[model samples]
Target: MSIPTLRMTEDLLVAILLGDSTIQKKSAKHELKFYLPPNKQKILKMYIEKYKLQSLICIEGVNVETDFFIVSNSLVLERIIREWSDGTSVIFLDPRLLKNSTYMLWLCLFGRKVNNQVIIKQNTLTLDTKHTLIYFFEKTMRTSFLRLNAEGHLKVQAIDELLLASIIDNRPSYESLALHELLTDHSKKSFLQKQEKMKEEMREYACF
Candidate 1:
């Protein structure tokens, strides 16, 4: 799969990072264009919504140029960093420079600082650590689900393993061969099933 080429200005990113710019709740209508691998998409959405990311955008993919504030976190932090690793020009904000809303998210999403530095996984430099956690967590969750389903103890219906694998493996960023090597059919199905059930439970118990 081909790496996505992001076309944007560095100065704007710097402005946002430096707290020199302001973001409104709504900006001019812009189409957000991002094509992540399939498996990564759900993970990305989870991070975005969990972080209330739209609060940080001055303009989001509307005109030829748009500004955004990205709140990097566990599942999608590595992906965001990977996008910036190719000299794509990412601006990192000093923790103090962030707005109240941004600061709240950083604290809630990333946790408190240890010593003076906060341990965050943003780019490829930290991808190994972040991906390792994601991989192991997903793998463990998948195993738990498969064990339950196999024992005829499913909370709902189950789908074919191959189909689930296809959903997780067919994203544009990761090559099919790579995905195939990374995730077995059974593992992918179990992972997807667990993810689906988790979402259903969250919605069922969501407040307001």
Candidate 2:
């Protein structure tokens, strides 16, 4: 069976690593393991299928009654482990990996909506990684970032949530569609306002 392109797989892997996944070495092969609640199993499976990944094995957690794990092994995964892992438990992500907005949208699956805003809790991320990711979001997505909370969780605040919704609408993947469901009604209102303003500007330009 053929696997997805390297770039696509790498983006998915990076998004997974940002969530509840880890990389471990067994003998000479590197394995990507994802630990999530049973409720999240469907999303995890959908993500794997969406990426057309191969050799991924899902296993029920032996100790945790409410959780399970998925294990995936591939040479591409090994390359990711070597490039992203710091030879320790901490994973150092390069900001360049944020190029794929679709995968970035998938990262929202790990986030929760609060007060009409989506907040991604990055408590486990290192300081450098957190800052870099914040920079990437602000520079590319027109979003805002809040200072780290008491728990060391960096909160990403979308000043205009519709910007994210627009990205999700364009992708039309399972992950994107799921994230779209989490968007607040305020985003729809904002999107409509932006559309009207754009139309007005276009009409004015045409008049000239």
Candidate 3:
């Protein structure tokens, strides 16, 4: 199947990828919902339906896990499943991480790739789809810590870019990282620093 023209604009796409939104914490219920700008949310709703991804969630709870190709678009699924029938799968991560920008920042600090398991990040999770560190960061942010304001608008657009840029600096390499990083490299220092911190956190997560 030929790839359809992705109608999502670059700016909106970035917001969606980053999960940009204002957050609200409800102590009583302990619930969260990431919101996009009104226009953007409408756009996303349409895309989700068009892509038939409304029910595509694979991983459950805080950590998500699922077959890669199942959630991918026809174009990507066809390409990835060709070589490996089983292909690779990814973890969606916990929603809480969205609120934990520090942790989110740390995860994207490195371009991580280990054998067949290509772990990067994106706003929406797709099977067999290699995720960019920035994309991954945005996913965690929206799923975990972000939401739309009462008026149904985004609160921090500029801040999102700054945060995204800072997170990019945290990632060292993208070539061996995710397919998305095949050619983009602007933030080497921050990426390296964030990488070290992540290693420590990984040890902690593993300890429990």
Candidate 4:
């Protein structure tokens, strides 16, 4: 089996780390281009976390351009504009995480501190994030759905939808070996069974 990979600029890498990356929602590549921000880790800790990434790898600079290999387990954060343009960024979040009102509140407060436009593509249909928590939380449903589908969530339409759509829309992005690996996986659970499971999980998330 093999995995997909990614090769992006360092600035783009930071945007991903911060989860402030963004892209056109219509694009199949939207899964790789969601929004999340980093607020706690120091630079050293962040480096350590990434360096030790089980699903990520940061190789040394060489004479030639570097490429990153990602698989179903990972995603490369999206970049809509130059990282230096401003503080703008985006990342997809886990809907279940929204139960933690503290995180949502912080995002709202941060939006105010920035005092700039904040938009969520799924909600505002624009490239921004300075919006209310409820809006962003709602936006997570759509954005996170694509991401979960890509990551092999059982309820997500596997071969027929997001994964297959990506195969067509993102053929060149995935290497031949990685694509073969993705094409070969077989899940035994029926769609109804998966739905039942997803519903149970949703119940837990809804409690918050």
Best by TM-score: 2
Error of 2 at 19 (Å): 1.4
Which sections of candidate 2 miss by over 4 Å?
1-4, 23-25, 37-40, 55-65, 102-105, 114-117, 143-147, 159-169, 184-208
**TM-score, cand. 1 vs. native:** 0.20
Tens digits of per-residue lDDT for model 2, 90-147: 4566666666453454454455566665555542357777666667666665554445
Each prediction's TM-score versus the true structure: 0.20, 0.68, 0.20, 0.22
Error of 4 at 18 (Å): 8.7
- lDDT per residue for candidate 4 within 1-208, as digits (tens), equals 1321232222224323323223332233332233322321222234334434434533221222222212122243323222222323333333333432222222221221111212212321223332333354445433222221222211111322223323334532222222222221232233335546668888999999
Per-residue CA lDDT of model 3 for 146-194, tens digit only, reads 2233433222212223334444556322212322331124333444455
Which candidate's lDDT is highest?
A: 2
- Put the candidates in TM-score order, highest first: 2, 4, 1, 3
The segments of candidate 1 whose C-alpha lies over 4 angstroms from its true place after superposition are 1-55, 62-123, 131-208
Q: What is the C-alpha lDDT of each candidate?
A: 0.31, 0.57, 0.31, 0.30
Better of 2 and 4 by TM-score: 2
Candidate 1: worst-modelled 10 consecutive residues by lDDT: 1-10
Clash pairs, model 1 backbone = 30-62, 38-171
Model 4: runs farther than 4 Å from truth? 1-19, 24-54, 57-94, 97-132, 135-208
